[model samples]
Each structure stands twice: as structure tokens, then as C-alpha cells.
Target chain A: MSKEMTGAEMVIQALKDQGVDHLFGYPGGAVLPIYDALFQQNHIEHILVRHEQAALHSAEGYARSSGKVGVVLVTSGPGATNAVTGLADALMDSIPLVCISGQVATHLIGNDAFQECDTVGITRPCTKHNYLVRDINDLARILHEAFYVAQNGRPGPVVVDIPKDVQFAKGTYVGRENIEHKTYKPKLVGDNDKIQQAVEMISAAKRPIFYTGGGVINSGPAASRALRELARLTGVPVTSTLMGLGAFPAANSQWLGMLGMHGTYEANMTMHDCDVMVCIGARFDDRITGRLDAFSPGSKKIHIDIDPSSINKNVKVDLPIIGDCTKVLEALITTWKSQDRHIDRDALDAWWAQIGRWRARNSLAYRQVADVIKPQQAIERLYAATKDRDVYISTEVGQHQMWAAQFFRFEEPNRWMTSGGLGTMGYGLPAAIGAQIAHPDALCIDIAGEASIQMNIQEMATAIQFNLPVKVFILNNRYMGMVRQWQELLHGGRYSHSYSEALPDFVKLSEAYGGVGIRCEKPGDLDAAIQEMINVKRPVIFDCIVDQQENCFPMIPSGRAHNEMILGDMAIDLDAAISDEGKMLV
Target chain B: MSLAQEKTERHTLSVLVDNEPGVLARVIGLFSGRGYNIDSLTVSEVSQEGHLSRITIVTTGTPMVIEQIRNQLDRLVPVHRVRDLTVEAISLERELAMVKVRGTGEARSEALRLGEAFRARVIDATTESFVFEITGKSDKIDQFALLMQPLGLVEVSRTGTVAISRGPEAM
Candidate 1:
């Protein structure tokens, strides 16, 4: 049934077998043969991007929402290099991606010919696995292995670098009978002993809080409910990392917001206040614990992450569980027999009561006395408009990004995708295009910063070309808000060039790109703009120009403790202002 | 204006093929089937060559699918060796692309000044872009292309990249 074909043809055919619809990439020398072969295939559509970075992020967007492997193509040398950041981001966040790059002919490799680089070596650290195809016949197997590696183990990026000569070589397109992984295997089943120990720790603790991260999303809705049931049954408060926002209902009574710099004041404080912090899926990045020494000093840490390296990388853990969250939770629950009065009696209730007091007495306020629209309020409004619908929300980096992470909660897993670790700029727009392709029925949005959105504004053409429905809500503050906010607070307000003097009229730009453009300059026009975007069912860019001076508050300055927070409206010193606790932090 | 002005391009590649069952046999079968000539061929397992060896190959093609090889190789099984000798412009792509120009007369003198400004050179200059061998990044080649465009975009050749892990590391 299978005959001779080039590695290029086989790869394309394999992608076709997988039912891939759209691919994003740009061209170069070493990869010419593949392109030539690819020209004959019409089943898959390839979107040409301005930069390689955009290609990877776009693929990530496609994969995160669809639970499929997003594929990208780029030429050798610089093209492969540009995709590294996006690959690292996907690897850390566990998004499925398959990236392919061309190479110089194999003979002149180390001699450094026209467009050659050791791509497999370069991407090894970032990718779950990488394959360099010398033998054209092995092309089908390599792709199959790459996809299997990317989608199976914790879901990450995989690279397949083919040489120009190899691509043109005649190869047989015998499909991979099945995937066989050797090096990287993410364990989905937990050990009985470890599971029992985790449960015992949970049951014995006086004050316990479930601290989670993006891993919960990969666990899907079923496991999430299981974790929530465990929390509900035990009456423990729950919190999340920035990536873990939608893992649980944001409005639940025991919910204690996200934990990090710009984390909810109570969540960050709770991490410190609790006697036991059961961290799940999140590696305690520096942003989460500003000063590790002061981070949960009084707490006994139980760090549970699928990654063995992350087990004790950031925050030291007394009890470490290394495996997939769903598997681990299932094992723990199986070993855990339901108990009635196993609660630490008054100790647990008192902890919960204190968190309640923090909310009742000092509800982390971001409201302005003069009625200026707060970023949090904007997020709240977006969430209210969507109404727990299955929507894909992609965000650009900085303050607006943090705010969206802080609020605008979703219910489904893989519904939210952002550049979590690498913070690649110009990620939002292209990613939205990819997301729209994966989830045509659900609303797809890019919550963008003015600076970050411009990074991939050209992708508007890709959206228009495909007639994909992608709504872009530009949180236009006319500044690099996150960097600017840091300058305002930590650097004594010494202004930098974060101010953009030649900011484009985004609405006009969107219109120029063959999409509907909606501008919301005031709160009154917000709903109409959102409605217009939803109704269009095509790409729409909404320029929501907000106050230029606002900052994302409840910030834990770098190298500071959770308790040391600079709340919003810090121009008026909280020391001089009345404190509900009747004590000044200063 | 002239066909000669377009210059010539050469490419080298290293392929990582799987040394398993009939994987390499099938891949070699593909190459011979298509009648594509490989300039050079080298195979050794960078990671357990007995089980998974890499095959380094060299061949030349027009700009058309210089981008397609790796895309194709990535689809192969056991074929682990496929890296572009030229993948700089996209990754840290630049600071890795070297400019080689040839020149003479006013063209050569002007090329030197311009190359110096862009931090380029006369690594081998007879009379063109000075064979102005400027090695820095992929962007440098683009800048060199522009500068040479006026000074005579003459004959240009570039070595894609010989990049390694940034830290004291190897990949």
C-alpha cells in the first residue's frame, strides 16, 4: 500500500493522517525540498508568519485548546533559533507542539555550510524529545515518535530536523504502526506508599491549604472535580499559581486566589500562615516566592509535581509526589477512606475563619474613588459577559496579563493559554488565530497589552484569510504596564521610556487588515463593543483604551515577603491611612 | 541586472537516522528511489549509535525547500540525524550569519569602509563585497546585503550557523 516518497512527502502525509488542518511557518534554504513536496498537498493549510517565534506560539495556541499537537515549519539557522523561546514556554506549560526545521545537506554539516545548525542539540533541553532524520525512509517513524513524545509525557514541544538532501531522498511512507518511547516517560500511575503518605499528611495536618498550578488543567475536568471533592470533604482552603486560575471555581468560599507576586493578598499570606502547604503541579518560581527564606517560613511544604527536577528545585518540600496529577490524586483518594471527624476540629475552622476575616475586613480593593475603570473590574466584566462559557482566553505579557490571570476565570481545562515561563512577546494575536481554528464553536480571545499585541499584529491577515473568529481585547494603556509599574513603585517613580509616543490607532489597523474594528474609550461603550465582537463571528480587534497610569497592585516586590505588599493607590501611604488591623505595615 | 550577479549557494547537512530494524534501509530506499544525490554522507549515533545513530549528509538545492528537509526528516522514525547547517536567522539566528563578499577598485575600497562600519571585513577580497567576510549574526548578512546592494551586491556566500549551547554545555 505504501511506496517510495521523500521525507518531506511522508511528513506531510503523516500530518494529513493526523487530520491536521492548519500549520504556521516561514521558508528557508535547507527546507526547500519539503516545501516543494508540501506544495502538492492541499489537505493542510500553512500560515506564513513574519517571525519564527510567532510560529511556535501560534502552534501552541492551536494545541492547548484542541488537545492536539500543533505543527510548525521553519528554515535552518535563525528560524530554528527564534522558535526556542516559544518551545521553552510550551515545554514548561505542557502544551503539545511539533516543530520542524530544515538543514544544510548532511555532508557539509560540521563544516558549517549555508544554512545549517545542530537543531536537535539546540532544542533538546526545551523539547520533550528531538529527532534528526538522516535516513529519508525513517521520516514517518520520527514524526510518529515526536508526536507521541510531545502529547504523551506531560505534553511539551518536540523537534524534527531534516536535512535538505534527506528531504529530497526517496523514502517509503509506511505509517508508524504504533509509538514506542524510550527515554521520556511521564508516570500517570502513583505509587501506593507515596499515595498513602500524602493522604496521611493531609489528614493529620491542623491547617492545610491546596496550592495548585497549570498541572490541574492537564489533569482535565474529571480529576479537577476529584481534587475539589477532596478539598470540600476535608474543608481545606484552595489557592493556585498564575497558570492554575481555572482549575477550580474562583468564587468558591474556600478559594484563596492565586499565589505569587501580584497574587491575591490573602492567597500569598495564606501560603505563609498555613501550617501545611500542599503544592500541586506548580514549581515555586521566583515570582511566587519573592524571598524563599520568608516564603511559608512556618509551613511544612508538600510539593507535588510531575517533573522530578521541580520536586525540590524552588521551594524545599518535606513530602514530594512525582507523577501526573490525575493519577496521583486517584491513588491518594483510593487509599484515603472517607472520614467524618478527621478534621483538626477548631484548628482548621479557625484558619478558614481568619481568611474570611481578611476578605470581610480588607477585601483587596482596586476601585478608584472617582469611578475610573480598574483593570480588575475590566477582567470582572469580561468574565461576566462570557458567563462560564467554554472560551479560549490567550494573554500577552505584563500587568494586564497578570490582571487577567488574577480574574476572568474559566471552567474548562485547556481553555486558557499564555506564555507562562518564557513570556514571549507578540504571542497573543497569532495564538488567537490558532485557538480559533481548534475551537470554532467557543469564543476565542486575546487579552493583550498595547506593546505585546503589536508583536504579532500582522497575524490579522492569517485570521482574515481563514475567516476565523478571533476577538482581540487590547488593554491599551499606551505603556509597557508591568515594567512601568515596577519603575513607579520600586524605582521611586523615575519615569522610563515605557511611554509610547507614536501609538497606532489600533481600530484603524484592524480595519486595514480586513476585520471589524471596535473602539471602547469609555465604560459606557464597553458592552456594545464586546457584543459587536461576538456578533461579527470573524476576527475583530477592540481597542479598549484604559487609564495610562493604573498599576497591578497587591504586588510582592522582588526579594520581599508576601506580607510586604504595596497595595493599589500607594501614593497615599497605607501607614498614614487607617488600617483595619489597626497596625501599620510600615 | 545580470544572471551572474545572483551568485551561488551551497549547503551541508548532518542527519540522525534510527539504526533499527529496517528504518535506515527504508530511508536509503527513499533516496535512491527519488534519484536525489547526496553530496556527502556520514552516520554515527550521537545517542547510542548502535540503537539510534545520526547520519550526516550534504546536498544542494535552490531556495525553494531549503526549509523543507527538516520538516520532512522530523516525520521519519529512527532517522534522528537531520539538522540544518544554516538555522541562524530564526533562532539567535544572527550574530551567526557570516558575510563573504568579493570586490576590486572603488568597489573594494568602499566595501572595506562599509564593512568596517557594520563591523565586517576583507577576509578575502579580490574586488567584490571584499569577500568581506563579516561574521557576527544572521542580521549582519542582511545588513551586508543592503550595503553591498549599492556597492555592488556582487557575489555573496554565507555559512548558516555553528551554534552551541550558551553555557558551559553541549547538546
Candidate 2:
């Protein structure tokens, strides 16, 4: 049915039709009309965030946790500029986001009027697509199209900049049914010939590995199921990127933890030595493939990704399959079963034995301190307390993020949300808020660092305002631990400015923000404190003081090949000889 | 790129993009941000009904660098298609330039003589000065302009290169 409505009303109506239940936003003069329209409606719940950046990150959290296209509303100028970081983050990670920002009136856009800036100009490179809606009649269509483009092929963030004048004008409200475009249809099915080639490579391999990535999770739960099934049927060891962690069951015997800069010994070795590598849904980023020339030097690679540009852009593959991960996996399984092909059990057993020897290195080993808690120990306790429950994990960047990825075992997709590509600091708190809002009854926690957590600490107000029982687990290590670690190893131990001197007390800060706080300094009290934070039906910031000098290891120094990795088992003596180049102490 | 084959080659690329604000900026930003040199650039709306604009860029780079530029341009969302006219073997390229010559006596008469040889028409004339309008390939205009430079050439304004493939198929 056609209905005449104001531009603001049309936006709300379009969002309603598109099944957007929650919106994260911060109001300003340019977006006042949209806020007014929101005030009159009860169908869509509006979440007022403390900052525009937090709104986008929180929406990201909500999107990443629930597999929904997150929505955001902000005013023009600073409001839009504040969102640039989050937009870049979403773009690099392929997170689906629709950000609607209000611009100055159309007549005053060219003039230096109040809060007027070229928002579309600033955001063009950072967004998947963007629009500047001039006519009121086009507003509804543009809004719906924004949602479609954000959630469609190789999903990423899309922006719609609406001038204030359009918000006051009247327009016809056309829903999603009437807002289709002919130019942007993305192909979903992989080419059959290429799928056959990949299946053949998989069936004939000896040292085979399934190197999965975030694309599997983004392809939805079916892709993850297909991946587990493929691993079971093929008896292939699976190694995931940091973003691809939960796509394969972490608890499964075939799982090789994560493979990257700080990844486990077995995982990195497996990647280096695999003969037939099936890489699903992950880009070969520099972080994943350190010193690309020496990466998987002998592997016959099969890369399956939805985006065609990502194929052969970084590392060329023997066979590139462009399709959704779910559909491609289904095709591979069908072909493998129909051909009645099986991997030679003797050669596979040899590969498994080689992997077992690598796993025995215990690269993650660290000496325990009796008085102070180690960051790794903190994550271990956090996992032990929450392993049996339904939990969603989010993280800020640095050493703590690596610890969380290493220590926390995620058996399901869409349960772990972190800023992987951009590695934006202060992403965890607001993301946790968004996750908590989406799954209110589930346990959502932001595993954070003392230095990184302060970046978006203001979002604590939003959690209290909404009464979200989100837990903030801070591994308080006094320094920007990652930066300090690098400086110590790479720069002759000149700490520079990596330390935060006048840090605020988290217990006091949490109380000031009208939430509960707990500080666990001793290793013995870690589990009980975690239990308390979980049981408290309000936002709790658990400040677990940790060892400051500890560094994240399994380190491949910058520009070094993957095979030249330094394990942490003899880390203490290596730390003592700061300038020694790969000298052994064992 | 190898040290033995490091010589740069000039290539012209024709790109079709959405006709909207900031689309041009995005294209130029890609070039400038990557430190690639643009020798000549021109843009205009080619299809009003389709709301599509065409941009022609002349750049010099190695084969590997040229391929990188093409791949990066292809990655832009609003860019519908990009065709390398240099790589297509058969294509037509043209540019128009208006050259003004300020002189009296023999210099002015010599300018007219050169204009006739180059097929440049005298679009505007005075007793002491004349403006000649010439249209041809960029190299032809460059040669004609060089001849006019000694013949009392004052100022020259030239539209950048515009090209099209020599076939019925439209890009």
C-alpha cells in the first residue's frame, strides 16, 4: 500500500519493513527530525550511545554476535567523522553495516553553515557504497538499498547521507519489494568446473589442511557445519585465522588452534608444510602470511572466496573458487562422496604424526607467578568458568586480544567478535553492549587490556543506561603490552611511551558509572571473582591485575619467514639476552 | 618488474563510473594516494540517461605497475568498467588545443603558414594576433604547438586525451 509520509517517517517505516529491531545512535541538530520521528514510534528501539564511534562499534558488536546487519544513525560533520574509524574497520573485516548520517540542509551544503562537512566525500573510500539523497522521494528507496547493499555480496559497510531539508519534506514510502536494482546482483554459486578441480585436489592429497577463515562464519551456520563435516570425512587438520577462529570447532581433535603471528606451534608448522591446502573464506593478509614469499611454499592452494578481487590479489592460488562458502562446501562434499574416493590412510597417518611432534613443543608454556596473575592464566580461568555456558566474547586490541584468541575455545560461529583487520582499540566494550542487547539472556563479555580498554571507556554509561549485564574483564598489565613487547625485543628495551602512568582505578570508575566492580590481584581468587562478575545481574568491570613484563611469543619478527618462528618455551632467557638473534637457552 | 626491463610505458585507460559527486574524487584519490603520476586526465558525462560518466587517464608506469593500477581501479565500487585503450591495439585518441600567437609582420604570417600546414583553423584574428584551433592526436598537437612556439606563440590551452575503441561494441 502507498502511504504519504515525511522523510523521517519514511526512514523509520523503511527500517521497520527491513526487519531492523534495534538502532544505535547519538542525536545532534542535523538528525533532530529523525530523532523526533523515532520518539513517536515504539516498533524500533533506539539506543542512545555516548559517542558516535561507540554507536557504530556497538552496532558492529550486535551484528557480529547475532549475524545481523547492524544499523546506525548520526548527525553530520563531527558525527560522521567520528564514524570513519568504525567504517574502515567494518570495510576491512567485511562486516555488514548501514550508517545513516544527517547532513546540513541542501541549500546550505555548499556554504560553511553550522556543522556542514562533505560526509560522502570523507566516507567514499571507506564504505562499500554510499549515497547522497537529494530528493525526498528517493530517500525511502536509498535507505532500503543501503540495507540491501550492506547485507549483500561480500558484505561491508554502506552509508546514506540525507540532507536536513529532505527529512522535513514529504515522500512516498516504498518498501523493500519496490526497491530492487539490476546492477548490483552478486553471483552466489561457484563455477562447477573449478569446484570439480578443487574436489580432485582434496581427494588426492596426503598432507592436506583446511585453512578456514571469517568468510566461513559470515557465510552463516551452514558453512561452519559443512566445514566440520569436510574435516570429519577427509581427516584433515584445520587451522583458522584470527577472524576464522570459531568457524571450526575449537574442541575438535582435528582443530589446530589458530595460524598467524601469535598462533600455536602446530598450526603454523602445519600451514608451512601442507601439500594440498583448502583455504575457505579467508584473505591471505600479511598478518596471516608473514613474509608471503615463504608462506606454504610447497602447497597446491585452493582459495574459495565470494569476492573475485580478493582472489590472486595477495597470493595466487592453483584453483580459485568464487562462491559462497556454504554452497562451495556442499558441492565439494557431494563430489567427494559420489566418486567414492578416500585419502590414503598410511600417508595421512604420517602427516598426523608430524603434526603431533610440532604440538609437543608447548610453545604457549609460561612460568607461573605465585603473587601476581599472568594474562594467560586470567584467560584460562575465564574460560574454565564460562566454558559450559552460552557466551559471546569481544576484545580490544593488543596482547590481551591475542591471549583471548589463544586461550578461549570457541566451538560455534557468531560467538566471538573482535576487530581483526583494523585492530581498532576500544572496540570491545561497545561491541559487548551491542551483543548483550541482541542476546540479552546470553553471557556477553569484553576481554580487555588496561591500556586498550581506556580508549572507549565512556561506553560504560550506555551499558548502565540500558541495564545490560555485560561483563568487562580487564587484564590490567599497566602498559600497552604489545607495544612494550615489540620495543623490548626490537628496540633494545627502550620502553618509550608504551606505559600509562596515571591510570584510573577501575573499581572506582565502575562505581562512578553506576555499575559494580571487582579487582582480583591474586591468582587464587580468579575463578571466584569471575563467578561473582557473572552472577551479578548488572554491568561489572573485573580488573584482574596481571604481570606487566610478559610478552606474547611464538613470534616471527617482522619480514621474517614463517619457518623461522621463535617459541616461548625458552622465553625468559631470550628476554634476558635482549639483542641475541634466535639464540637458544635450552 | 625486473631490472633488465625497467623502462616505463605510457598507457591510456578509459573508465566508466557512476555520475555522482565524490566519485571523481575517489578516482583521483586512488592515483594521488599511491603516488602514481597522471600525465593527462579528462572527465565528462557520456550517458545522461544511464547516469554514467567516462574518465580518460594517461599514466606512465612499468608493466607490473600498470597492471596494479588497473586492478586497483577495477576494485572501486562505482566503477562499472575500465578499458585500457593502449592494450586494445586498435583505438582512436584525440585532443583539441587553441593556440594564441601575438606578433606583427613576418611572425604572424609565418604562424598562418604553419597553421595551414597543420590544418589548424584561425578561429579568431586581429592585426597583431591570431588564435588557431587545432584538433588531432595529442602527439600531432604537440608538434604543431612546437612549431607555433617559435612563430610568436603566446599561450595554449589543450583539452586532455579522449579515446574510444575501434569497434561496434560499446564499453
Q: Rate the local accuracy (lDDT) of all candidates.
A: 0.73, 0.89
RMSD per candidate (Å) reads 16.3, 3.4
Residue runs of model 2 more than 4 Å from their true location after superposition: A571-586, B1-11, B34-37, B60-72, B86-89, B100-122, B125-132, B142-155
DockQ of each: 0.01, 0.31
Write candidate 2's Cα lDDT for B38-147 as tens digits. 99999999999999999999999876567667866876767888888899647899999999999989888888999999999999999999999999999999999899
Worst 10 residues of 2 chain A by lDDT: A577-586
TM-score of each: 0.74, 0.93
**What number of backbone clashes does candidate 1 have, counting pairs of residues 3 or more apart or in separate chains?**
101
> How close is candidate 1 at the interface, in terms of C-alpha RMSD after superposing the true interface residues?
16.6
| lDDT tens digits, residue span A1-586, model 1 | 4778777888788888767787889888878877887788788888877788888888988887776789999999998998888888887788888898998888877787776777876776677667778888778878877777777646788888888888888877766565465544555676677777777788888878899888877766666877777777778888888777777787678888877888887887788788888887788887787766778888888777666556655456888887788778766666665433365778888887788776563435766433455566667778778865668899998888888887777655677888877777787887887888777788899999888988888888878887888888888888899878766654566668888669888888888998988887767666766777778887898888787888787777666777777676467653333333222111
Best by TM-score: 2
In model 2, state the lDDT of residue A318: 90
DockQ result, candidate 2: 0.31
Local distance difference test, candidate 1: 0.73
Alpha-carbon DockQ of candidate 1: 0.01
